[model samples]
Target: MVPDDVVTYPTHWEADVVLRDGGTAHLRPILASDAEALQAFHVGQSERSTYFRFFAPLERLPDRDLAHFTQVDHQDRVALIAVAGEEGHEKIIAVGRYDRSGPGEAEVAFNVADDHHGRGLGSVLLEHLAAAARERGIRRFNAEVLPNNAAMIGVFREAGYVVRQHLDDGILAVSFDLDPTERSLAVMADREQ
Candidate 1:
């Protein structure tokens, strides 16, 4: 377990999760060395997936953006990635992150590889991220998801949180409290079983 006093890294957050498909994936806090895997994950995503994630047709992840994404303080800014495969061959299949935007709120986002969609990566990441955020005293999460991205929306809407959302222009503004309520914990427990 990572001591609360350690502000630099939180390796205790790493966990092994079982996906909906009965397969397994490793979830861990983002590391500086993950830049290459993150880049490859970005490059491998379909055009539609990329558009949904970045809201633009970004063909490449710029160096600055890559650096910013890989580096996190594990408190106000946190990112977790899901990976599968062997040690050296492990590949990042999904990425989820939350950036604090207010005194008790943070902007959350996620990107799951197209080929690995529907395997429960988004929901698992959300649970872990919420736990991490709560430990840091964050109480709320806000997300801006493209309205047409039903996959991502379902992950949040069905997460058992009291979700409030509105469509502005074409983007969906989503917000929910991070505290795990009875229903939320039940849903997570069911998924775990």
Candidate 2:
């Protein structure tokens, strides 16, 4: 187990972070220290999810990608993880990021462990991440999901994102805009599931 003291909440320049779920999951700034864990997680993803995320075959996280994930400034980029830590279970199960595209706009992306999907972690992470982004001056948050990724699509749709299937950056994409009050998400979450 990560001694309770060893699992410290990460710091962020972009927002006030919090550790929730008994620190089994946390909303914190991704750091250079996270490179190895992030790389390993991506490397371990299932082939299908790897293809969905990269839009191609990738066996491991390329150095450039690792560098970008670990070193970007908070204004230009930031990431979060749902970390699990116990004697035999120390790992990052879910991850997401937001990269600034312009004033008031950010391109966001998220992924969860195959075993953890459909358990509300993605929605919870989005709720926290979107709120954090809003606090950091981002009014519009966008995401790109492959046409075949129905689980992610369901999450976005359930979150009340106005999604339009369109060709973006040469691939099918689904974009999301976060409402500050989350009325849309709450209402959508209320409907038949």
- Per-prediction tally of clashes: 0, 1
lDDT of 1: 0.92
Per-residue C-alpha lDDT of model 1 across residues 1-193, encoded as one tens digit per residue: 4434445778888999999999999999988778999999999999999999999999989999998998888889999999999978999999999999989999999999998999999999999999999998899999999988999999997788999999988899999999888889999989878
For every candidate in turn, the CA RMSD to the true structure comes to 2.5, 5.6
- Give the worst 10-residue stretch by lDDT in candidate 2: 13-22
> What is the clash count of model 2?
1
TM-score of the candidate numbered 1? 0.95
CA deviation > 4 Å runs, candidate 2? 1-24, 87-89, 167-170, 185-193
Candidate 2 C-alpha lDDT tens digits along 1-193: 2223324333542222233232345445566777888888888789888887778889988899898976656565767777766623558778778899888888878878887666666766677677777777887877777877888777777776665568777666666666644666564355323
TM-score against native, each model: 0.95, 0.77
Worst 10 residues of 1 by lDDT: 1-10
Off by over 4 Å in 1: 1-7
Highest TM-score model number: 1
